[model samples]
Target: MSWMLILIYACVFALTCGFSYWALTGLMPSGMTQRLDSLKDTPHFVLTEPSARWQRWRDKLQRALSWLGPLSSATEPEDASHTFSSRLRFYNAGIHSHLAPLVYLASKTVLTFALPSIAIGVLWYSQVSLSQAPGMALVLVFAMLGYYLPNAILAHRVARYQQALFNAFPDALDLMRVCVQAGLGLDAAIDRVGHEMHLSCPELSNEFELTGLELRAGASRADALRHLSARIGLEDVEALVVMLIQADMLGTSVHESLQVHSESLRTKRRLLAEETAAKLPIKLLIPLVFCVFPALLTVLLGPAVISVHEILAPTAQGA
Candidate 1:
């Protein structure tokens, strides 16, 4: 039974990998179509073949997962604020899929049941017997862990993305300041900065690119800037947005505002670095006490203790 279970798991894992590979390679539209489209002088309708079997399967799975969304919402209807916050989190983590929230909820639900089922299967296969209470408790514990796992992963992604944005903001501001001082309009400067920062600071570049896109799509500059700040979810970005809006409204010098904000951001970044450095010793204390100190003490006292033991052993035996 154990061998059979292991074989089943292996087959399932292999099948999943195969599906993933097929979806990535086979389902994606070929570059040939893009090249052909680029070469055409006049725009013409292009007829393409239907999606592959893998794509159909993926679409079906997505549809099935989406069903869980309504069920989840029916059970626990999120408030407008919560929905907005979830959207912000998803955006921050770079998930722009329309079905992201549905997929996330579905995953949580599936794991909540799947983990306990796996645990039970493992226990049954191992022939381990336990009291009913303890068995239920174990299942519940696994379910809880699995249920919260996605949240933990999302939180980590948000933290990492935010940190990247924070680190890149000062540089982006300096670039913007230079661009503004060089006679570029605010929108043009933003677009230029986005392009220039693509290699060095991709997260900020992406935000700026989206803002430029919104501006081009007919959004007001202030609205686009506010949306950018909201998507970034950073205090520095929010401050920059407010300053730019105020400067634009008051017809003040944007270049000067950018320069001043850039300097202040740099100072804040320096202070943050110093604060982290100051906390380094306290952070290191735990490892020093629990790990390094023990090893050092063992090394220093080990030889003397062995010598004493050897000398005492002979004397005690003789006596």
Candidate 2:
């Protein structure tokens, strides 16, 4: 029995390790970490000597968890030592990051332990009278619900944040264009737009601010934009970054590029609006017939039905 338990523990451990590897490797696209390499130059507070030692410890743990593999050894040119620290800080922040996954992991662990323990205790208390364990069935259902409900909520929040970022991005680009055309450098334009957009789209604003800081701190503008695209994980942002990088490499006019991108983004927004408008009738049909149409019919025909019933009933009685 002891050997059986040992084997089971070893199997569980191996399975867990395999799962961790897969998760770390598979969560993001192929070039994600390369893109995040830009965070090295963003302005952040320096650690004291003691703090630095503590940070090194934290970073080791993060690297293990980050599953950076070969990428972990690669350093950013600008702020080589501080790069990992900044990324760790970003991960800890509440802005649509991976805390949800950690929460889910902890919750599942607790539920896995708690559900069976509770079920066994209740069953023992009842003296195990019922065969097939009705209590066990209830416990299983509740456990499934408890597990899935939080996941569903997290999925919704993540989706909403992604959509919000996607919707806010083109506007951010336009703002950047305005600032650039006003004679500001790209970094300055980014900072201005980021500050202005804080109230409306705090997430995008924060990311832009980070990008501007990276650019100012000696990271190339193209590198910073690439990092921004990775952080947001949106195709539009990626395309914009690519466009900006190409313009930089070719020594084309930044102002003209920004203008063209702004126009293209506006057209995209128009198409999205049309698509949503097209969906409205389909989305509204259920409520329109079941809710609105029934109410309208009651309002319009109720009195006439009552009048006909009254007139016909008396005439039939006379006959």
Candidate 3:
């Protein structure tokens, strides 16, 4: 038994498990911490200052992986950061961090080797090498699964976040329309809507609120709208962004554009609701067939089958 190899394997396994567990079961910030994320807050300052032993270690590990962000971009210099960076993906999933890409890249690196190391160690322990078909196949399968698992998790996160945003957007849009009709500017309407939606739809509210901040900070309306669409990564939002941009450029009525867009979004939302309702029966059928129907058949036929068996068995035995 090689102690060094065993130690390396253990380290890799620990790192992989820690990252995956953290990604799946995220740390929940308190309500006040989440809402007020400023550096002056108690929790934020505590995390910022390396007073705790764990904080010091975490900061060291983060510095080690921080290089991967630039490495990811350097690997695809011709493309935009959003094209090659996991930043947009993380943003859409509500993970706003400069270190997210680094963590993601490090996870891929660890997982790419972690499973294969375990498999190869097992093969070696069994006196088999990768030259053999079974060993090679096992290593390949583990490696592929390791590499793709992060991607699947990210997609699931994005899907769930997007669903929440989609469900919440209509009401926010209606509020924006009302504000616009009341003679408020688009920026003011966005700010008011975001502030109003704090209780109902915080995620979308945060995005809208950020957009309004960018507007107040003197960013162009088009740029701010595009940022909103990119952060959301939703087709409906992209469409709205395009419409708003076009309206702004053409000097058309922003309220009219919003009104029409709001109605279209409502129609789409209703249709999506109908589609989901239609899918309910099909989704329920599998459980009915496999679970419910078996119990139902057992209840309905068990007594009859038992009676017939009793009657026929006695006659057959007597005869």
Model 3 per-residue lDDT tens digits across residues 1-319: 4434644775798899999988766766665565666534344212244459877877888998876545534544555765645578888997886667778877776787898998898778867767867668778878997878888999999999899899888888889989989999888999999888876777888899889989999999999999999999999999999998998788898887887888888899899899999999999999999999999999999999999999899899999
- Report how far residue 249 has shifted in candidate 2, in Å: 1.2
Number of the top candidate by lDDT?
1
Summed backbone clashes in each candidate are 0, 0, 0
Q: In candidate 3, which residue ranges exceed 4 Å CA deviation?
A: 1-58, 66-85, 116-139, 306-319
| Residue pairs clashing, model 3 | none
Ranked candidates (lDDT, high to low): 1, 3, 2
C-alpha displacement of 23 in model 2, angstroms? 38
Which 10 consecutive positions of candidate 1 have the poorest summed lDDT?
39-48
Across residues 1-319, which tens digit of lDDT does each residue of candidate 1 receive? 4434644774798799989999898877665565455647644324356579967977897989977766546655579988898888899887777778888888888888898898788767666444556556667877997789889989999899998888888888888888888889999999999888865666777889899999999999999999998888888889989999999999999988888888998899899999999999999999999999999999999999999999999999999
The C-alpha lDDT values of all candidates are 0.83, 0.69, 0.82
In model 1, the clashing pairs are: none
Question: By TM-score, highest first, what's the ranking?
Answer: 1, 3, 2
Top TM-score prediction, candidate number: 1
Evaluate residue 227 in candidate 3 and report its C-alpha lDDT on the 0 to 100 scale: 94
Per-residue accuracy of model 2 over 247-285 as CA lDDT, tens digit each: 878988888888787788778878999999999999999
Q: For model 3, what is the alpha-carbon lDDT of residue 205?
A: 80
